[model samples]
Target: MSLLELRAVSHGYRQGGLFAPRTAKSVLRDASLQIAPGECVALLGPTGSGKSTLGRLALGLERPWAGDVRFDGAPLHDRRGRIAPVTRRAIQAVFQDPHGATSPRLTCLEVLAEPLRAGSTGKAALRDQATALLRDVGLDPALLDRLAHRLSGGQLQRLCIARALAPAPRLVLLDEAVNSLDLETQALVLGLLRELRRRRGIAYLFVTHDLRLVKGFADRCYVMQDGQPIEVADPFGPGLVPPAMAALRAAILPALPGPRPLRQPAAANAVLP
Candidate 1:
C-alpha cells in the first residue's frame, strides 16, 4: 500500500478584490500521485507548473477543491475534517529556502529539539537527540550553539533536514529542498538524504524542476504540467524519455557545465542499526 496518496485531486486559489467577483484560479486538475514505503518519487516540472501547490495539498496545508489525500489508506483529514496528531507526525516537509523554513533567532540545537521535545521532556536528553540528528545529516554537532542566521546555506539546509527527520516521519515532502543551494552543496545534501533513507526506510516525494538530479535519485518520475501529471517514467530503466520529460530536459539551462551526475552516498556509512 502507498504511504502517501493523492487521488484525482484538484485545487485552486481565489483571486480578486472585495469589490470584484472572486474567481478560483485553478492550479491542479485531476492530479494523482502515490509514494510507497521506502520509495523515492519525483514530481518534475518547471516554474508555475503547480508542483509546490500540489505539495501543499499533500501536506494538508490547504484543502483540495476536489478528490482525496490519503495516508496509509485513511483520509488525511478525518470525518470531522481534522488531521490526527499521528498523521501530522508521520508526514513531514523540507522546502527550498532553508533560511525561511525556520525562525532566524532559533539556534541549531533549538531547531531540531523543537520536534523532539514532544516525546522527551528533559533538556539533556533533547540535546543528545539533537546532536545525533546533526551527526546523522553529516553536520558538526559543535555548531548546535550557533544561531540559524549565522550558519551557511548548506549548514542551514542540513539543519532543516535534520529537523524534518526528528519526528521519525514515514513520508517526507521535499519540495525543491536542494534547489536553493550551490551545485556542490546540492550534491552533498542529496547524498545525505539518500543515506538517511537507506537507514530509516523513509518514503520521499522529491519534488523538483531539475531532471538531471532525478536521474539516479528517483525510482520513478512524474512530469507535471498545468497542475497535473502528464507523464510518468522510470528513471533507472532503459527506455525512451516521455515527451513531456524530453521537452523539460531540452529546456534545462545546463547548470552543471558538462555532465551533471547525481551524488550517491558513500557505502561505508549508508546503513545503520
Candidate 2:
C-alpha cells in the first residue's frame, strides 16, 4: 500500500489578485503520484517546473486547489483545513537551505529536541535520542551545544536530518536537500540518507533537478514538465525510458558537477568547532 498519494491534484497561485478578479497561474494540473514504504522515489524537473509546490502538497503543508491528498489511506486535511498531528509528524521535510530549515537562534540539541517534545518521550530520553541521532547522521554530540549558525552547511544539514528523524517519520521529503552543498558534502549526505533508510525502513521523496543525482540515488524517477509528471521511469532500466528524456539524460549525465567554483563552501567535511 502506498504511504502517501497525490490524486489528480491541481493547484496554482493567485496573480494580479488584490481584488482584481483574481487569476491563478496554474502550476500543477492533474498531477498524481505515490510513495510506498521503504521506497526511494524522485520528482525530477528543472527550476520553475513546480517540484517544490508538489513537495509542499506531499508534506501536507498546503492543500491543493483541487483533488485530494492522502496519507496512509486517509485524507490529509480535515474539513476544518487542519492537518492531524500524526500527519504533521509523519511527513517531515528537509529543504535546500539548512540555514533556513533550522532556527539560527537554537542550539543543535534544542533544534533536534524540538520535534521530539511533541512525543511522549521524557526530557532525558529526548536529549539522549537527540544525541544518538546526531551521531547517527555522522556528527559529534559536542556540536549539540553550538548554535545552528556555527556549523557549516554540511553539518547543519545533517543536523536538519537528525531533527526530521527525531519524530521517527515514515516519509521524508528531501526537497533539493543537497543542492546547496559541495560535491563531497552532497555525496556524504546522500550516503547518510541511504544508510538511514537501510537501518530504519524510512521512505524518501527526493525532489531534485539533477538527473545525475536522481539516476543513481532513486529507484523510480518521475520527470516533471510544466508541473505534470510526463514520464515515470526506472533509473537503472534502459528499455523503460523515453527517447527525449534519454537524450537529455545523456547530455547532462556525463559529469555531474559538484559545487560550482564561487558557491563552493570553504569546508564541507562535517567540520566541528
Candidate 3:
C-alpha cells in the first residue's frame, strides 16, 4: 500500500469581502497522487499555484471539499468525528519560514522536546531524544540551550526538521522548507534529508518552486499551474521532457547570459515570490 495517497481531491477558498457574496475559488481539481514508503516526491509550481494547499490537505490542516486523502489506506478525515492522535502523529510538517515555525520564547531543546511531550514519552527520554535529533540534523548540541531568536535561519530550519522527526513520522510534508537558506546550507540540508530518507524509510512530500532542485532531488515530479496539477514526470528522464509543462516552466526561468561563466559562481539571490 502507498504510504500516502490523495484520490480525486478537490479544494477551494472563499474570496471577496465577507459581506459580499462569497465566491468559491477552486484551487485543486480532482487531484490524485501517491507516495510510497521511502519515496521522495516533489510538487513543483509557481507561487499561488496551490502547492501549499496540497501540503495542507495532506497534513489534514484543511479538508478537501471532495474525494479522499488516505494514509496507509486509512482515510485522513476524523473517524468518529475526532482526529486520531496516532494518525496525527504519523504525519508532520516543516514549513518554509523556520522562525515562524519555531517558538521565539522556547529554546531549541524545548522546541524539539514539544513533540515528545505530546507523544507520551518521559521528560528525560524526550531531552535525550531531542538532543540526538538536533545532532542528526547537523546542529551542535550546545545550541539546544539557545532560544529560537538566537539561531540562524538555517539552524532554526534544522530544528524544525528535527522536531518533525521527533515523532519518527512515516511521512514529512516539507513546504518550501529549503527556499530560505543559502546555497551551501540548502545543499547540506538536502543531502541530510536524502540520508535520513535512506536510513529511516520515510516518505516526503516536498513542495517547492525551484524546478532545478526538484529535477535533481525528486524521484517523481508534479507540475501545477493556476491551482491545478498539469503534468507528472519521472525526474530521471531525458532533459526537459515535460513537454506539456515546458512553456510554463520556461517562462519562469530568468534569461541567462550567453556562455555562462564558470569557476564556481556565487549562489543566486534569495527571493521567494
The number of the candidate with the highest lDDT is: 1
Model 2 residue runs over 4 Å out of place are 19-21, 120-122, 235-251, 254-273
Per-residue lDDT of model 2, residues 1-273, tens digit only = 799888999998987866688777999999999889999998877788789999989987789999989989999999999998878888888889999877779998889877888877797898888889989999999897889889998999999999899888999999999999998999999999999999999999998877767756787888776568765656545675655456557778666566767766668676677
lDDT of 3 at 163: 91
Query: What residue runs in model 3 are displaced by over 4 Å at the alpha carbon?
Result: 79-81, 234-244, 251-273
**Tens digits of per-residue lDDT for model 1, 160-236:** 99999999999999999998899999999999999899999999999998877887788888988667876565633
What is the lDDT for 37 in model 2? Answer: 90
Residue 96 CA displacement from its true place in model 2, Å: 0.5
- Writing each residue's lDDT as its tens digit, candidate 3 over 23-56 gives 9999999888889988999888778878888898
Q: How much does each candidate deviate from the true structure in C-alpha RMSD? A: 9.6, 9.9, 8.0
Quickly count the clashes in candidate 1. Answer: 0
Question: Which residue pairs collide, candidate 2?
Answer: none
Worst 10 residues of 3 by lDDT: 248-257
Count clashing residue pairs in model 3.
0
Error of 1 at 125 (Å): 0.5
